[model samples]
Target: MTTATPQKIRQLVDKLELEAALAIMATVEHPTAEIDYLHGFSLLQVKRDLPRALELLRRSEKAGFAPFWVKYMQAMCLSNLGRRQEALVALSSALGIDGQHVGALNLARLWSLELLREHLPAETTNILKTLERLIPIQTATAPAAKATGAAVRADTNSDAITTDDALMMALLGNPRLFAAPLVPSSGVSGAGIGGTISAGHAQPARHPGLVAVSERLMGRRLTVLDLACGKGGVVLDFLLRGHRAAGLEGNPTYQQRPEGHWLALADHLHLVDLGAMTTGFGEDRFDLVIAWDLLNKAPAATADRLLRLVSEQLLAPDGLLLAWAPPGADDDGDPDGWIRLVPPTGLCRRRPPVTPAELPVLPGLVPVFHSRPEAIPLVQHPHRPVRVVRGRNGLPALREEHRDDLPRVAVISVPKAGTYLVGHLLKTLGYIDSGAHAGMGGFDDYRDLSPAEAKQGGPHLARHIGLSELTRLLHGGQFLVGHIPCTFANRRDLDGFQKLLLLRDLRDAVVSHMRFMADAGRAAGQDWVDIPHGPDRLLRYLQSTGRIYMQMVAGVRPWLDVPDMLTVRFETLMGDQGERQAAATIRALSTHIGLQKPPAWNRIRHQVLGQPTKTWSGQRSRRDGLWTAEVENAFAALGGVELNVAMGYSA
Candidate 1:
């Protein structure tokens, strides 16, 4: 069989002709190791045959194909296979051998930032910074439309190319490779992977602020009305998320769909003068009313009337009023004045748009204020948005002026502890989401550590948060989250950050651990974690796993004593006494961090607590007392009771 060129296969892949690509793979009979590496890499996009793909990548490595490509793709496979810890370790190793490979770094930047959070390991950070420094592509109009037509290319070079099947295959896989402007000169950048994008491939995202806000509020469906929205920019943001969002633009130009501008959302855009809105215009009260710069533009009295009106009628009790503040003589003649009717409970600030949305009426980045239970004084909410599959770790910071007044906080807790509950309080208190969540940054990642690695524990907070990353996190308005056992290394690493340690009752912790493990195991297709039946097998499982359970019960001890750390018990923030204790905890936390207590605690609590976090599997059996007698007796027999007492929990 004639060894097919990579260009032909890539053309097929680009045109969505999978069978032809597979046929090219079928023709490889006595392939070299490099071809095998290429073959394995291409299979990564295939879903069911991943195990075989992994096997080939390993085989390629053993056959001396290339240490860098083999290990790098292996890390990608591991992550996709739901083995993130192994993937991180594998990536760290591969990066060591890469020696600042530019193409490799560019390919892996999004994944690295996604998995590691903003403060990455020192090695990954260096590579990504290099990628960030690269010049963006010149234009999107690459002349590579049919560039991968290797199959029908003149046969003069066939004899020479036939000798290096791998090289031909590599080029065959790059669709835009033949386009001079599209392909960079550094040939070996994505040698085996076959996928590469210059910085300018896609257009910049429009209305990132709106995108961010959509993602943050994506936890639930809500009706949002953005007043004075030109061309209905906010509609597209919520449109993708299935939220019903519309614009009330008084400008007839926008309402009628101006000649040059898009009227894509003309149906959703209502031609109503917001300045004259004294009574209800929309029949249903909105869950979120985005009065973008409406209040700021009106006179003080008119603004106050609009504020009282939005609060008293237009807004649902739990609705948010995102309004800009009027220029005030109220704050002793300060320009950035507060709203006179009701103070804002929660505030949001976002960086200005780099390329503002089309007909952007302060689209998402207008830096408007967010109000709960009333009209918002003009402030800013960084329209923070993230993709479901793509993580949002390296998002730009809130502008200095907006963030200076907010608080910086860190919470380190055990798995299944009250992570989201505290996160809820922090969000309500005006802390921006730093794109870190306990779902990924927890002991869950630690479970993959080999016994030797686990025993030789070092700084376990995201494995090692760099000093520079920690410094930026110190800026007010954002909070950090991680689940780690207290360690000397962690204590040293978290030295400058304000730390809060959260723990749950050991008995509840142990029970939640079991259920979580079983549920997670099933979700990951690890059927072996399920015990077959009855007491004897369960006893065998316990004998092997009992130590891990005890560790969850007790691992948070040293965390309690970190210098000036505010120790918050998970039970205190949830369960029967949750309302009373949570209020107290928030007050204590605000005082400890020296930030103003965010108002409307009940409303924030209702919105936050009512939503289920990503990690929430079901009604937590903790409140139901699932393993009370049996687990307690066994734990008592194992001396966990003493440890529980030390943590100030009941015996």
Candidate 2:
């Protein structure tokens, strides 16, 4: 029997004539490794048959054909099949064979960071280091050019080219990788990854500001556009409210009809080149335009051009444009005249200050909302500003009437006291949603401000938003959750707000803190604050930090005295009676916040408890006994007993 040439088989595969290619290969008397690999590749890419693809790839591996590529494909198939551990090993084998293989290295870094960060910290670090070295560095003078199709081909062997390089090339061309479904394992601490508030479902407890704004615009026929709408979560929420809404996303991949199950309103999403000024939308097409986190990422010129285009072509006359403006964005060429709805604060020290001429501007747009500097410090971004502007194309500007009667609530807690859990529960119950604000500076206490301090240009507190601004947020139905120390200065800010203070056993909190610090240290590549491993280190650190901890506890003392303030013990929420305790806490919170009707408690309960609990060390259970008598005596000597009693814990 004679065999068809490899070149002929390749041509058939290239044309996507998979059946013909397979038929041709079957006639080959003794098939080569290349034949097996090509058949497998076609099975995986063309037919999307994972099981058959894996089978063929394994056969190709046995035939000793392109071992690295075969292993890599096997790993991808295994991952898709949910065999993550096996996938990791296959990926590792591929990398071992060809250390410089970019695709395999990228996958290794992603998988290790996602699934094995705790189990394989060193390996994760090495993968990151390899990626850093392999990825070209870009400088101001010469930007990193997108790799062309030919360049991608040049980077890989011909057989390997069809598998790994094609995927990487697709990713390079699409640029909408940000819109990829977030892997469940990739979420950082205090971040909400899943369980989005679906359209028309009761509003989520998070992002109350968005809900309040949406409510104000309700009862009107308005066309809304979300610019650069990554994953279109916010746009879906708008659609649920029965509004005529559309999302313009730059990523081509995200522009496709989203999974119908996830979004029934996916038809409204459109893909456009956000980098281009002319988006082809008709003039005055949208009544409201939202551009979140877009301008800050673009070059100054591109940003200015995009804003002008948005104002002139996209936004209706008198339409509102809500944008995020980092500090220094308001300096000189303020073309859009974006008024800071909230005072700006530098969120990170590494951010360079924006000069007047460098500030993004859209000509003819004017700020309708002016910020009052005298209001309470808005600590969230401290450095970044939320700008609201009106496209003044000879139309009457719509004014936002502040609703003063909305219920306001605040959730305050010490660090590492399961505040995230409480916040998640509140979100599930359809209360104020502030998920965006969870990891921001405003959610932190003064101790957490040290990083912001290095970036501060003037008085530390000067960057904070004033009480008036905070009141405005509350009036807009914002839910404030933070670890803000209850200082006298912050008391006035807390006044009249329904408050909830979350407490945990100090010892447990200390243990949690130690684990958190260690994890964070490893992640940041920093030393663990001079503390050694074991109980002695924990005890000594607790002793040294007792005053700060006491201060945190003391901050809540005044709130405890307030009749309306709800106090929740963290242990109860974690105990065997956790569900009952959580339900009761929710009820107390609902009443305090003046909810007209209670949320679906059972549903919220399931959502809250169903979440996978994250633990740092299995030894955490054993460490409870690590507080020896001497440690207890030392802690008491440092005033832990008084603080413990004040917080309702038996010391």
Which candidate has the highest TM-score of all? 2
lDDT of 1 by residue, 161-239 (tens): 1111111112122111111111111111112221111111111223535544432332223456666565554553444
lDDT, model 1, position 174 = 19
- Model 2, 1-651: lDDT tens digits are 444478888788777788888788767777677777887777666546789878778767755567677877788887888766457656656654565555565566455434523333352464333323323222213222111111111143321112221222222221121122211121112222221211212212123245234323221224567766655555644443333466655554433332211132234555455565354353225545667555555666666666666654665433455565545545534523232212232111112122223222334321121122221122223343333223222212111222233455677776566665676676565554432222111322222233323223222232233332443343323366655544322443454466788887776776676666554442132233465666676676565444445445544554565444688777666654666776676677777766667675565666775353232233332246567877687677756677778788887
Worst 10 residues of 2 by lDDT: 145-154
lDDT of 1: 0.48
How much does each candidate deviate from the true structure in C-alpha RMSD?
23.8, 25.6
Residue 491's C-alpha lDDT in candidate 1? Answer: 41
Q: What TM-score would you give candidate 2 relative to the actual structure? A: 0.35
Off by over 4 Å in 1: 1-402, 437-474, 522-528, 532-542, 623-630, 633-639
